[model samples]
Target: MERFAALYEALDATTSTLEKVRAMEAYFRSAPPEDAAWGLYFLTGRKLRRLVGGGALRTWAAALTGLPAWLVEESHTSVGDVAETVALLLDTAGIGGTAEATTSLTTWARDRLPRLGQLDETERQALMVSWWRELPTRQVFLLNKLVTGSLRVGVSATLVARALAGVAGLPVAVVTHRLMGDWTPSETLLPTLIAPGETAAEVARPYPFYLASPIDGDPAQGVIGALDAFVAEWKWDGIRAQIVRRRGETFVWSRGEELMTDRFPELLVAATALPDGTVLDGEILAWQGDRPMPFAVLQTRIGRKKVSARELTAAPISFLAYDLLERDGVDWRERPLHERQAELARLVEAVPSPRIARSEPAVAGLRVDEHGVDRVRVELPLPPVAALAADAVGRLAPLE
Candidate 1:
């Protein structure tokens, strides 16, 4: 972290971008014998100038600057910590709130650990997870964007983790996994995650699984045909979730993975029929006749842990089981898309809809949970995150 921080500090010291780049290049290339490291190999190659002169000049430079930042921060994350944190932030913040959320997160991250330390791998990871929970919606959004440091301004989660990995003598890949959480981090409990002894968190409610930028909002930004190659989806506007039913206990997690069972008891009851030791991705839609009930219909019953019979009848929740990530103790992440689909189909058949969504007494049969009333519970809806091919959504589309 000190090395990366010093790099950033050097960037601050320079007056010109070219000089800053050159100075960094020189420092990395001519690092002292004791300081010389393999990761700095980028400096020894033609990459820096190539990155600067690249057609997309800004992107290359941004990527370079952000790597260090991500490395520094990510050193503090781990498996159990990453998934829970990601789940929470996705449910709470989404992407629109990125910048504001980042500020709170940086502040909390500062408090969580000393800026400089001779810490080991585990200590660093614990630190990152500790303060992850305190972040607000905006901070969570910002944290999610840390992957590529896709945007230029804030520190990237990947870079933070990378730095941590480098210092702690852990594999960079491992660190990245911990930092790039499967669930939303900032929206949930990233603050507490980095703290100490916290485990099995639920994501934040009200946030979606992923935040998509509005392409139509700026059609002229070369978006006219950009979506053509993409596998389009409704981008369902509703609460994002992950449903875990294990050993007869069903847990409803928001995208942030916060235990949301009490907030929407109807869904928990419906989850009772699921096979023991199963994880399914689904939407708790405002249900009416097997279709998505209006979001307005769901508003009547959200956030209240206890619901009256009238409330249950008025807004019945349904779990739209989309994909199954785990079944019968098998980790199905590495399976091909078609294979996963088959597995999901089998699981669905085994569990069946009847078991997934129950009816309120006297309220006909199963209906999808309406939006706003309850939330959606996704499995490890992301293959990259879940290590599967396709998530609960449609088939994976190629990025342009």
Candidate 2:
């Protein structure tokens, strides 16, 4: 707990990326592997669900300090964060003596936090008070944040992966891939995650997505050259997903790195048609006939543990595959976009489902001025009109 608290303070105090990475690397090197595993889990944005509510926590804190409930409420309002307020009140009131904490991050998470959920209110309160008396103010703040499940400390998962990669002497891409999907912090898993060799079971993890920069202004005026170089497709308003079929198993991952295998059952059924060791980058849309339904319709299915037959029928989903990242266990990311698209087209054509298809191309608008300069413009059907600059569009090798 003390080591984690110091590391957290170091990370929280700095805005420099290099400093943050160094801090993380140093902590990973010195801390126990078990505690380091939990540290990585929490610092990399995996949070436990809220174990205690604000009202209950505040009441308990007030009881511990022998302070009036209204005074605690007023302090909370002034602090604007219940966790910080409690930490401050406890610190100033000196309710808990200067005792030190001997618990490690793993012990606190695996043994203490889980038990809080099972205990009756009185037992839970007593346990929390005892913890407060033993732990320092900084740790109390962190514990409160953990109990409330609101521990956002302004660090990106990418940075965390980069630090781990540096520590393990592995590629950032490898670390990033290993971090994806459902993973728990375990002694064995942590070592495997940082290990150099690739394992057969890790095939379901998705690669980091390639995102495009938004283009602004008139497509014709913005682009300096002819429009033939770029291929234009409708950017569908839907969830961007990567579908992986490896070792006779299919996994669906959202761009946010969530493994959403069960929510969209129909997509999983359709994915069976894909060949093993294939990874497709696509958009998951709520479809009605040939066109996509509004995004609101798709929101109903998000985060659902189970999709009923009626709900599946109502919000029938389809995957518009746009890029092929892998084929037959081979990485295709370094290949040009056109080549990737060609393979994706072939794969989609082989699938028998109407729900799955290639993204439709938009008609390119072209014009020649009296000065004899060729100008090209493409307009999308959706709002926040997207136009591709001719020079930028031409840079992408058009799929044959």
Candidate 3:
């Protein structure tokens, strides 16, 4: 816990990318695998969800420090962070406990943290106060931030991947892909990540998603050069997901890297139509007949452990696939967009489920010149970010 707090401080204190990478590499190299697993989990932007809320933290901090509720509120307002405010107040009280400087990051994250979420309010307060008194103010701040799900170190995923790649002597792409999909903190995670060749993770692991960047608006308005060189599609307002059908099993991974196979069971049924070694990158939208439902309707299905029949009927879901990332066990991410899209169209046509459909390029206003070259100076609604085969959106190379 103390070591993690120090690492957090080191990362937070840095504006230099090189410094942050060095700090992370040092921590990964020295920390125990179990501890490193948890560190990687947090550093990769995963969090302990629904553990504790700000209101409860504020109330508990006020009670623990013997400070008035109003003072706690004022301090929180001034500090602009609940975790730091609570930690500062608790530190001034000079509380003490036996666990100070002894508990490991693994022990805190794997053993204590989850238990904290399950306790009643009284038990939670008691346990948190004991921990508060034991840990130094900095660690207490980290604990509070973890509990509240507000721990932000301002490091990009790319930087973290670079650091891990440096530590393991692996390519950044390999490290990033290994980090994608659903994973939990464990002793084997670090070894598996740094492992030389293919391992069990490859059986179900998803490719690192080709993400989009924000652009001002319409690329056709001289923002980007020629339109015929690009194929434009609607940026669907839905969850960006990778559906992997490998080894006769289906895995649905959100862009956030959550394995939500169980969240949308309809997709699972639809996935049966897909062949093994097939992976599709697309959007999952709540659908009603031919059109999509309000995104708000889709929100109802997220994070659900089980979908009741009534709920499934009320908000049916569909995967509007746009890219074929893999087919027949071959990685197609290196192929041209048109080539992948051509294959994707064929696969969508072959699939019998309405739950899966293709997001086709908008061709309403396309024109061809007298020389028979396609003149595509169409208006786009937004500054488009495209997922080039080998690159992320907006960081595009010309279509081959």
Candidate 4:
């Protein structure tokens, strides 16, 4: 816990990208694999669901600091952050103890933290207060951040990937890809991640999602090529996700690396039509007769653990597949845009589910030929659009 707290402080104190990367590289190289795995989990923007409520923490902190609830509330508002406020109050109390100085990050994350969920209110409060009194102020701050789901180190996942790539002596792409999907952090997972050979990926793993960079001016003017050199499709206002059907099972993952297979049961039914060992990257949208409903309609269903029949009827879900990443147990991400799209079209046609459909290119001034790019140059009004390219992965650059 102390080492990770120091690393967190170093990362938070830096504005230089190189300095942040160097700090992370140093930590990864020295920390035990178990600790490193958990550190990477949080640093890469993955979060554990909130274990305790903010109200509970505030009440407990006020009681522990022997301050009135109103005063703690005012402190929280002035500090503009609950975690920092709690840490500051505890530090001023000077209650830090030596007993927890050697607690491992793995011990706190894997062993101690999870026990809070099963504890009653009184037990939970006692346990939390004990921990706050014993831990250093920095660790307490991180603990509070974890409890409130507000732990951010002012770094992007791309930078973390770069640092890990340097440690592993592999491309950044490989490191990012390996980090994708739902995988538990364990002692051995780090070794597999840095291995030189292609270790078998989890059967339900997803490829890292490629994100769009903002363009400063008009996209067509700044593209530096003929207009037809690009392909455009509607930037579907829905959950960006990947559906993996392998080993006679289907898994749906959101771009945030959440396993959401059970959220939309209709997609699971529709995915049955897909062949084994196939993966599709696309959007999950709420649909009406022929077109998508507003994104607000989809939000109503996203929070439900079990979709009610009324909700299903209110907003039907559809998976509009945009790219094919795998087919028949083979990876197709390296193929050109045309080849992958051609195969995706054929596969979607064979599927019999109306909920499963292809996201075709724009109908106006668009042409498809032997090559993905058509020679005919034309200008047309652009809606929200996504550009697919043959790169490290089939990067879907959404133009806003």
Worst 10 residues of 3 by lDDT: 386-395
RMSD of 1: 18.7
Worst 10 residues of 4 by lDDT: 374-383
Which stretches in model 1 have alpha-carbon errors above 4 Å? 1-153, 161-235, 352-400
Name the weakest run of 10 consecutive residues (lDDT summed) in model 1. Answer: 46-55
Q: What TM-score number comes out for model 2?
A: 0.83
lDDT of 1 at 305: 69
Candidate 2 or 3, higher TM-score? 2
Residue pair clashes in candidate 3: 1-105, 217-383
List candidate 3 segments past 4 Å from native: 50-71, 93-100, 118-123, 216-223, 262-275, 285-318, 352-355, 365-400
Per-residue CA lDDT of model 4 for 291-341, tens digit only, reads 888889999988887898999999899999888999997878878777888
**Tens digit of per-residue lDDT, candidate 1, span 1-400:** 2343345445446666555545444543443322323113222221111101111222222232343434323432442233223434333333122223323222322332233134554454343333334444333333332321221322333444444444445554443333322332232332322323313432211112333333233434443332212222223335656677765677787655356788778667666766776766555666667556677777776667678888877877666554555566454434554455566666656554443532111112112244321112233331111111132233232121
Model 4 CA deviation exceeding 4 Å by range: 49-78, 98-100, 117-126, 211-213, 218-225, 245-250, 260-277, 286-318, 327-335, 350-355, 365-393
Query: What lDDT score goes with residue 150 in model 1?
Result: 27
Give per-model TM-scores: 0.42, 0.83, 0.80, 0.77
Q: Please report, in order, the local distance difference test score of every candidate based on alpha carbons.
A: 0.42, 0.79, 0.82, 0.82
Residue 47, model 1, lDDT: 16
- Residue lDDT tens for model 2, 155-195: 78889998899999999878988888777888776678888
Candidate 2, residue 56: the lDDT equals: 85
Error in Å for residue 171 of model 1: 6.9
Candidates 1 and 2, the one with greater lDDT: 2
